[model samples]
Target: MNMSTELIGMVAGGVSTAAFLPQALRIWMTKNARDISLLTYCILGLGNVFWIIYGIEKSSLSLVFTNSFILITALVIVYMKYFIIKD
Candidate 1:
């Protein structure tokens, strides 16, 4: 990939990863996840795992990093929903 393309990827990845911040923060602060769909997040986290694997195979650092962050954020929400809040 060219420098411009790599930069684009990085920027896109950062934005995508940042998209989850608000929800995660809200759940953490409010300790309320009753409105969150556990199944949806589980599926999303699974998809992120597959994307991370694909990123590894393709040697795409942007994909791997972004998906990993998304996966972690999803897991955090899942944990808080299932364990912390039980909601």
Candidate 2:
């Protein structure tokens, strides 16, 4: 609620969301995810989904928004690993 707490939350959310952007962009551009771990992404995506659910239940905007974005990225990676790479 305080300015400092809000700032920290925004920063944390921004950083966490941004962390996955490069990997998503790489997969989108290269059309390759051969080296990516399918299991890891699957687990991470599931975890992201749970976080989104928790965020919704708790009414936490930061958690919801950040985890939703992460979920999207995770799904993309999973798709690439399974479908695009084809290996």
Candidate 3:
């Protein structure tokens, strides 16, 4: 990949990855996820997992990195939805 394309990928990945930080931080701070949708996150997380596999198959670093971060964030949301809120 050219440096310009790689740079774009990194920038896009950074922005997309950052998208989950706020929600994760909110859940961490408030310890409340009652308003979050469990099924939505579950599906999103699963989708991220598939994206990771696709990234691996295609050898796309941007896809791997972005999807991996998204998957982590999605897992946190799902965990909060199922486990934390249940308590």
Candidate 4:
């Protein structure tokens, strides 16, 4: 991978995934996933899974690494949304 592309992914993924942290923290703290959109997160989690696969196909470690972390975290949010989030 080119330095530029890696840098871009690092920037985008770092920012986006880091952005996911506050909601995660909130969900963990309050066990409240009410504000989280189940469908949106589900789709997002699936998208991340596909991203990891695509990363593997492309032999892109950064994409795989970032997406893996995001997928787990997002799945956690999804789970919390199911169990903790009130309808």
Candidate 5:
């Protein structure tokens, strides 16, 4: 991997991981995951898990690290949505 490609990968990973923060913050603060689709994120969390595995399989540092971190956060959101709906 050349320096330019590595930089692009790093940038892409950072952007994607950071993209989740705003939605997470909104959900955390408002506890209003009503706007968020439960089924969608349930699927999304599972997708994140798969991506994490794919990243590992491919030995992709950016994908592995970013997806793992995002998956943790995404799962948190999924759980939060479930609990909120339950209550």
Candidate 6:
């Protein structure tokens, strides 16, 4: 991978990973995940796990890092929805 390609991957990964932060933060601060779909986030977390495995197999740092962060965020939302919030 050339410098430019690697840079692009990093930038893309950063942006995508950052996209989940707001939702996680909102759920954490508000302690409400009623509006968030549990099924969707659960599926997303599963997908992220698979992606992490693939990234590891391929030795792609960007993929591994990005999916890990997203997976954590998804798990947080899932936990909040299922465990923390009653509704």
TM-scores, all candidates, are 0.91, 0.80, 0.85, 0.81, 0.79, 0.86
Q: Residue 69 error for model 3, in Å?
A: 1.0
- What lDDT is reached at residue 39 by model 2? 82
lDDT of 6 at 36: 98
Candidate 6 global TM-score: 0.86
**Overall lDDT per candidate, in order of appearance:** 0.90, 0.82, 0.85, 0.85, 0.78, 0.86
- State the lDDT of candidate 3 residue by residue for 1-87, as single tens digits: 677886798799999899889998988788888788778888888888998898889778898899999988888788777877664
Off by over 4 Å in 3: none
Give one clash count per candidate, in the order shown: 0, 0, 0, 0, 0, 0
| List of clashing residue pairs for candidate 6 | none
What would you estimate as the lDDT of candidate 2? 0.82
Segments in model 6 whose C-alpha atoms lie over 4 Å from true places: none
Better TM-score candidate (1, 5): 1
The best candidate by lDDT is 1
For model 5, residues 1-87, the per-residue Cα lDDT tens digits are: 467775787789889889888988888888778777768777877888898798788767777788777888787777777775443
**Error in Å for residue 1 of model 5:** 4.3
Better of 1 and 4 by TM-score: 1
> After aligning candidate 6 to the native by TM-score, how far in Å is the CA of 27 from where it should be?
1.4
lDDT of 2 at 53: 95
* lDDT, residue 85, model 3: 62
Evaluated at residue 80, the lDDT of candidate 5 is: 78
Q: How big is the RMSD of model 2? A: 2.0
Tens-digit lDDT string for candidate 4 (9-55) = 87888887898889889888886766778788889889999999999
Residue 81 Cα positional deviation in candidate 3, in Å, after optimal superposition: 2.7
Decide which is better by lDDT, 4 or 6. Answer: 6
